[model samples]
Target: MTSRYLDYSGNMDGELRMPGKDKHFQNTEDRTDSGLDSLKDEDYNRIVSGVQNLCIPVSATPQDYEPEPWKVQNNEDGDTLLHLAVIHEAKDLAEEAIRRSYRDGYYLNRQNNLYQTPLHLAIITEQAEIAEKLLQAGCDPEIRDYRGNTALHIACQRGSLRGVGVIVQYSKFQLPSLLTCYNYDGHTCLHLASNNGYLAIVEHLISLGADINAQEPCNGRTALHMAVDKQNPDLMYLLLKHGADVNKVTYQGYSPCQLTWGRENSQIQQHLLSVTEKSLQYLPESEDEDSSDSESEHSDDEYMYDDCKLMCQGLN
Candidate 1:
């Protein structure tokens, strides 16, 4: 399990606009309605109207009522209905809430029990389309819920190609960012999928252009380090086939093969050697800060990455 980076402090009192600016909590319904009324599009207008028309009844706030963030609704395990709706494909509710949030210009949220949004919920629930819709709706893909896992992080953790596909569709999705995204212990998405033996997600992410040799913040370990140390051969093969740099040393200067040697794991050692040879022959190229030959360890075979990281290894 990774560290859940679940700190939520957005659109609070000052971030919102309300008639009664003096009363921060009053920004709830009345002020929210006013904001919705400002949208220029008619469709957007109707959405706000519908949302106000269907406002979930809040217990009458006393004139002295104050808002507590926790007072927001939650489902089992403390997931909000919105959280469950997107993930579980409760579309009618999802769409309606989505529309309302958009109309109100406040749908972008990732503050659930695990600091996840409806988009992440959709991924967890296997609702790829809903996740796609949410991305197009301008949700923050970088938001890490309580688990220090972004929606991309969770989709990779789930190891579902379809879910990863939906996430990868976003043009702004920075594949290299996944390398930096860490769970509490500082393992990257690659580390998570590899350690869990989720080969599909691992491959899909690699295909979508994740950096195979990217280092995790904790101890500067790469995904290969985690997989080999954990004795996951399937993961080792996947990472190697996808072009992970096996020779690269961790902070302690130990490569994935070193772990295998320490444990006398011949199987892993052989796999690393094979992959390292392949990587040396054909290093991959990404269009990020580290693309030049100086950064590249050796001449690559034919790995190609577009504007964002595109796992175009096989295609090329």
Candidate 2:
């Protein structure tokens, strides 16, 4: 049998025995070079396990010990070390804290000065894996901070479909009701995604059975209207394919086709006009006529905050 030592720089030496193993082997080289043969043998695995079990980190003064903090959890910046860990790719320490939080139900909504969550930072920084892990750990996906926007909205605004997928996985139907989910700008996640040319996010929102034609207050802009404003022909094509009413008018009396026709997206304008005329070939009787009148507008602003508080208390 041969003795082995593991070093911080991943250097392995045969002469240096593992700590606590005072007995040295005479035939170190004869037992096969290095620990490869031992690794393949069960007896070697047991020896390695025993060595690991006996290992302990070197101690230091309280100030220097554990010098690396995982999160920047302070009132000034809402970011947690977990947020930065994911942002900067700090794996081991972040994983340890994440496991602890998972067990203790640590609801980390720490925002940096930006008032964003670890999840929000994940999306902004394009950390798809960390975002997924954080969501699974129960960081509220529907949570809104100072700007009154949810993680979904932030993902959409940044056009991070990868991040959006991580959020939508948790946010499908689970959420804190009060977030109105409508931001202070009076828009939904779908609205922001559609407005910002995030075709993939729009597709995901629609796949979740979101109202494709839902409008915002302050003049009633539909997804199609916002898509038109972005001059995105593909987005217009997507909205129309998803049953956007080309003839349906905004409060300003501008229909999708009208807005389309006025845009720089001449190809979209022509295509939308053609579709509007083609759809008029035959139409169904008014089923959602009255339903359309009562748009999904939230009259009470504080309702969302109150609902969020109630849900948080319940979870607590």
Best-matching candidate per TM-score:
2
lDDT of the candidates, in the order given: 0.62, 0.65
**Top-lDDT candidate index:** 2
- The deviation in Å at residue 102 for candidate 1 is 3.3
Over 28-136, each residue of candidate 1 has an lDDT whose tens digit, in order, gives 3454454655566676656645533442233323463443453366766766656767665678888766654442213356476666777767878888877777777
After TM-score superposition, the amount by which residue 204's alpha carbon in candidate 2 deviates from its true location, in angstroms, is 1.9
TM-score of each: 0.56, 0.59
